[model samples]
Target: MSDTTQPPFSVLFVDDEEISRNHFARAIRADYRVHVAQGADEAIDVLARHGAEIAVLVTDFRMPGRDGDDLLRQVAHEYPQIVRILVTAYADKDMLLQTVNTGDVFRILEKPLRADKVREALQLAIARYAERETRQQRLLAMSETLGFLAHELNTPLAAISLFARSVENDVAADYDPERQKDIGAAARAMLNNAQFCLTLLSSFWATVHKSGGQQSVAEAGGREVRATRLIASLLDTYPFAGAQRDWIEVDVQGDFVVRTMPNCVALVLSSLLSNALRALADVDAPSLRLEVVDGSEPEIRMRDNGGGIAPEIRARLLQDPVTTHAGNGGHGMGMIFCNRIMQSFGGRLGIESTPGEGTTVTMSFPGPRNRL
Candidate 1:
């Protein structure tokens, strides 16, 4: 909560003027670890020595040799996670726009920087830096998990699949002719489990690491992916593929395409499929259907015949991390991630259901461009 409690987070202040630097550092040094630079060159040296320790970079523009713009540009390229703020006396609309567009600078303060205003901006910048650190930590954890999954999960999967088939063959030879089908069915379930494990292992990593960067930033005009194709593919080969896989069906009413970051959609669908399978466990005549409606507003719908959401669960389903499977270690991040994905693409994820009846989850994007 306070810098005194933990290791101080360092903030670099770059200004040619000694008076300004000294005055500004005194304002916020109590809250943050301060590192002052006389000019752009010294700032570079300081950054090189303490880049890992430095969280915030506040530099004054219009320096003697190289300006704040140059320093911020270097920070953007080298330490992209660092929070960059530019302090300037002069203003050029184009310069500011370019710096902001390239994400080189987070905030711009006028030359006569007040302690109060600078402190406020620094606080926000530090918060941003903290968030970036958190994201990097998550990415690191996910990478470690994925790195080990190939050995830890796949090895056990091989044993299960092989042993299940061997048992089926051995048991079938000594069993009644009518019971042969039962042995085969049990063996098939085990094989399905193996397949599910494989799919999850591949899909989870692929979905999370789409562009293969520390942060996967989805570009506009991504390769067009069809809604029906994704659904059909998942239905046939998904983690939830089991006896209920036969009941899951896909229907494409007309031509429809999701033209942006389809991996996000795939990840969301995987989460939903897992939930649907869990809900259908206690229901009789379980069924899951995927339907894509093609028109002005193309929509992908997932309808599942399972025990529906409770009144309280339905109320705050997307609003918060509220899961019915709390006892089973469900954190409710899956649905939250799904909602945010739709929101990112100017779309809406709507859910409707009755207590006993099924649930229908609809995904409506900001319609496809051009006529088919």
Candidate 2:
């Protein structure tokens, strides 16, 4: 018995024979709202008009002019969410296997169609559609929540940064020179960390708003930025604790322009910088170098002389969220996130390390023509 409390979800049926279309509709119209087409062309036209309303497509494999396989391929590309089912009296095993492997058809119904079997397939297809919709909604909700938290955090971070700057500037001349220097350094560190946090939050907020909490790469556009200037900015703003800033060197082979999202680049640099700093914590006379190599494929390499990563851990660093500093609240997602961002920019992130020697992280970006 059809539940008539609400409008039934729609199904599109395509068959060349008039009797087959009529019989199929009559058998299932009580449970589903049916739309029938005489051939593949008519089916495409019907889809153009009611694609959003239709949840499933049931097309006979044999039809005049554009057969079911061709129609299924077109529909699969155009309307991926719609579940497709192929109905055929003469089922070609090779063709069936190919369509199934390519994910064009959810099910293949052998004809002399059983009403119970058809109904069962429709039920399962609808369930699968519902599951995809639910998963999409959850991801959107998570993105929105993260954006909201980032937005809310911006205020306090900005306030802290402003206060730190003020303290650094308003220090009294009556204090001893050495004492004043220590106080100023502390204030500067606080200010730098606060500013870095603000930068990350702002970028995240913009990304979420631009994509409307959806998954996309090209929605956030890129712009041309000078490589030397970007490296200088990162070095100036990065929160280097006590004498750590003195341990670093910058070497630019040539100046070039890179087209990418600067905020995203900054976020990646922050993650790499944090990791490098932690690794250098116990090393003597630590050295970190930022070298920009300009060519057809532009790159910024960060080389640090620190306790290098083990081979086993380095193997899965980018592929999985695997971290060595789990005891320090590391969830191991930093490298994974960085890798994803680099890929979205049509770029790549690579790492090389030798234990007891050092680690060098490379960020390679596409040339001007390949920018995303």
- Give all candidates' CA lDDT scores: 0.73, 0.76
> Which whole-number lDDT from 0 to 100 does residue 25 have in model 1?
82
> Model 2 clash pairs?
none
Q: lDDT winner among the candidates?
A: 2
* Model 2 ranges with Cα > 4 A deviation: 1-195, 203-223
Per-candidate TM-scores read: 0.50, 0.51
- Writing each residue's lDDT as its tens digit, candidate 2 over 139-246 gives 544443454334334443654666566565657545677767767766765666676676566655654565443333233443455777767777777657778888
What number of clashing residue pairs does each candidate have, in the order they appear?
A: 0, 0
